[model samples]
Target: MKNLPQKVRSKKLSSRVDLTAMVSVSFLLIIFFMVAAELRKPKVMDLSLPYYDPKWDNIITCSIGVDNRIITVLLDDNNRIVTYSGLLFYPIESPKILSYGKNGIRKELEKRRKNILEYSASMGKPKNGPIIIIKPSKKSNFKNLVDILDEMAITKIDTYAIVNDFTPEEEKLLASK
Candidate 1:
């Protein structure tokens, strides 16, 4: 009996667990988890620029200056500092007069339209930053402020400086001039 190998052949085959299907299931699960964990919400908030020197003579710009203190402006789609009518203001104050029309903002946008277009084409920047500034004395009249703002908006100046104080850097530049 021992020498005669048992001829008992099993008819039932072992259940072969196909791991390929399991692997596919695991991949699907991983993808599900990865997609579920990703964030898809849009966020919103204020995106104003950094205001340099928030405190000072409180620049109140107008279209024209009564005295010769008003800096001469040049506009050729590159330097839009002012127009003939409205005024623009930062650190918002009740202007005695305004050059930019009421509720008109983004003054610098008009002035540097040429530079902005060139820069946008070459550097991929959508708009150029205007570097114009007005340093009116604290006692400057409202009409002047109105006139300057009017000119500023017409020219398209989004960013400007109000000389409240001559920082050391400015003093050095002025002293050299």
Candidate 2:
């Protein structure tokens, strides 16, 4: 029996896992997450710009000046804002200097907002207040800017812009102050 030729037995090969489905599933999941992420963006504030009118004149301009402190300058039609009026193109009054906090700018803004609402009601027009122009000088500090913006939100005042230009009169006022 030892010298006789033995019959050869074939060995079975081990089966290998097909990873194509797993890879495809993984890719699909990655794509789904990427697309979903795009759809889940954070909400932001909505802003509506006014139509430019050549005749529209009475606009409120706020200037921020910093010289070891904060100075808030409110102007109407290039004149200072002593009172808040709903109409545009009003005459220039002496610009008022406002401090920060509850007793200062905040109070002034609240008063102005009240006046504006009242004026709008009397005029039988929508209570859309005047557009505010904000000019932040290089001397102004970050806190001052933040405070002004906060005051705007608190007063529910919209339609404001942060511009860099300063008129000659505004420059003179800053220098004098």
Candidate 3:
């Protein structure tokens, strides 16, 4: 028998998957999420605190002047706000319990502001706004303070202070309520 030539065999090719597109897409999604998170930030409110100095303590104690423009607000428990004009001992406006909102403290603020402006102008003094002294009692919540501060901002009040110290008279007055 004559020998036959061996048949040539074809080589099989191996299948491969391209991962470049998938990697790029995953990276793009990550970047997009990061940028979105950066753009969304929490809103903040600005506060201006008084600067303290040791040397001014003596000077403050010695100074004696009646400022009718001063308004003191005391924040007590149960969302009670006690407000008065001038010194607590010699108040121009008697201490009154006021609630929150436009009809409450806001109305009083606007009325006092207008009166103060008129009084200052008539006295031949520079048109100065009312000075608010916010005294938050220990029993009061933080929200009360923030709400009052918001009121000050809404009324366009420029001069205000957040004082923690309370006199004996103020304590007794708050106790009565």
Candidate 4:
């Protein structure tokens, strides 16, 4: 018999892949996205709503006399704002429709603040500035309320209240418009 070479056999290698690096990379990506989402969170504005007392049967009441220190801002539909200093019936300044921005409500607020400060000084009263009351009618939208609140902040008003209860007179006035 002629000499024959034996058949050479090739070694079989395992086909399993190493997934350690891939899993680690996926975890890192997940963490990065979570951190990014947290960093991109929206800003929030702090608002203080009026506190109610159960003891008081009538929460909304008219001032006994006209208070020059108080300013009432009524938010109506169609982006209309009615502002008056003191009582609506006996306002120091008559109610007028005002729009938003520097030329509109902002100007009026600044002017009123100046006038109120001057009046307080003249009367030998404390310079506590004017108290603003914001009333949003049912017809009004949330954006108007937010705009008004932003105005309050821009004007550096420290004292303000959001009163949803509209006076009958205010309702009538809004209805007239």
Question: Stretches of candidate 2 above 4 Å error?
Answer: 1-92
Residue-wise C-alpha lDDT for candidate 2, range 1-177, written one tens digit per residue: 479888898998879889999999999999999989988988676344334444546543322111101123443222222222222223233356656678876787676557556655665545546455666666776666676788789878875677778767566666665
Each candidate's lDDT (Cα)? 0.42, 0.56, 0.85, 0.84
On the 0 to 100 scale, the lDDT of residue 24 in model 1 is 94
Cα error, candidate 4, residue 88 (Å): 1.5
Query: Candidate 1, which segments miss by more than 4 Å at Cα?
Result: 1-113, 129-131, 138-140, 161-163, 168-177
Q: Is 1 or 4 the stronger prediction by lDDT?
A: 4
TM-score of each: 0.31, 0.50, 0.63, 0.62
TM-score leader: 3
Worst 10 residues of 4 by lDDT: 57-66
Worst 10 residues of 2 by lDDT: 62-71
lDDT of 1 by residue, 1-177 (tens): 469777998799889876998999999999988877775556576233433343435543332221111222212111222222122222121222223333333333353345545644565434534444564433345565566666566765655555555345333333332
Model 1 TM-score on a 0 to 1 scale: 0.31
Query: What TM-score quantifies how close candidate 4 is to the native fold?
Result: 0.62
* Per-residue lDDT of 73 in model 1: 27
Angstrom error of the Cα, residue 23, model 1: value is 43
Better of 1 and 3 by lDDT: 3
